[model samples]
Target: MLSPNLLAWSVELFIKEPGSNKTVFWHQDITYWGMGETDDEVTAWIALSDVSVKAGCMRFIPGSHKGGIVDHEDTFSADNLLSRGQEIGGIDESQAVHSPLKPGEMSLHHGRCFHASGANRSDDRRIGLAIRYVTPEVCDQAPGRDWAMPLRGEAPAGGWSCIAGPRGLFHAADLALYDSIIEGQTATLAAGAEQDVSMYGGTKA
Candidate 1:
């Protein structure tokens, strides 16, 4: 589990919203939280703008989180591990949520939620930021120079910080419940108020 350090978040594909009919393709984020037995994972998907269906807002199959992760194929080759059009044989496309998002607002869901995005037809950038959280009980299986962070143990409350560690990694079951007990640790540590990054934005939503 990621507690203090391995809080993985991605800014997005830096999307190209040229017009409609451009697809985001289909793929699942199963590789992040361990493949099958990964546990206690939560994610927050934030749209940087007033996202809409035409602007390529997120789409989620309502309640798809409960179904667990379905196998998926790479729909977009730009960010895929394989070449484009590679029909991945696991994603649960039939139950995907075409859920749309709003700027400043975010959607929190299980790591396994069935979701994806579409091509943006509107004349705006369809940018998104996704943040994921894991308890200090799930260790990452992949390794080597990939940049991992340890999220637990004794650390300063937050002043001009740069989490120092050996490539940033937590022992999963060893890290203390620092995140759970810290409460408003982020806000309290900020020089002034918070930036909504408490959950990634620096402040609480």
Candidate 2:
């Protein structure tokens, strides 16, 4: 089990075309997330295609999560995969570990872990699915309401409201809910109260 207090949050998909120079700068996932208090979050990175160092597989600094959230700056570079192109300064790349994966393999990392990926230098496309799970006890620090899907065990109250599954694709009711949620997210992130909050834009990958 990931954690008794944790619950699944969100998932994101990332695609890198062949010879793409785009890179994910060294950073911590918790830097931009709204999850409050607890850092008990995990991300499952599943590769849709064979990912090697040449294809820009993820790299990590072992035991980095123990250091908690580190400082990050928005590079806003067009070649960065992050929404705001945020990058952590003073990362010792010499201590990094390259993580290569087969098509069906997956790797798990803590939300606070320091990680990043290089530009795709291979001849084939690289795709990855990142599913994030967080503790329900964690509250959204950003202003505005939040929602989450309950996966298992006793659901916790407060922080995130539960939403029902959509009956069909592009269903009217579902679309309305989505639009409302997106609007709320936009407002929350646009407050610009802090560097991390301001840097929160779209999916990092």
What are the models' TM-scores?
0.55, 0.87
- Put down candidate 1 lDDT per residue, 1-205, tens digits, no spaces: 3345343322233243446444544434443233244645567777787678887665665664565556543343433221232233555667665667777788776655555566677877666666655444444443221222335453322221223332336754324433432333333223132222232221211
lDDT by residue (tens digit), candidate 2, 10-115:
6677778889887889988877566642566788999999899999999999999888677788777777777667789998999999999999899999888899
Q: Give the alpha-carbon lDDT of every model.
A: 0.46, 0.76
| Global fold similarity of model 1 (TM-score) | 0.55
Best by lDDT: 2
Candidate 1's displacement at residue 204, Å, is 29
| Quality of model 2 by C-alpha lDDT | 0.76
Backbone clashes for every candidate come to: 35, 2
12 Cα displacement, candidate 2 (Å): 0.5
| lDDT over C-alpha atoms for residue 78 of model 1 | 37
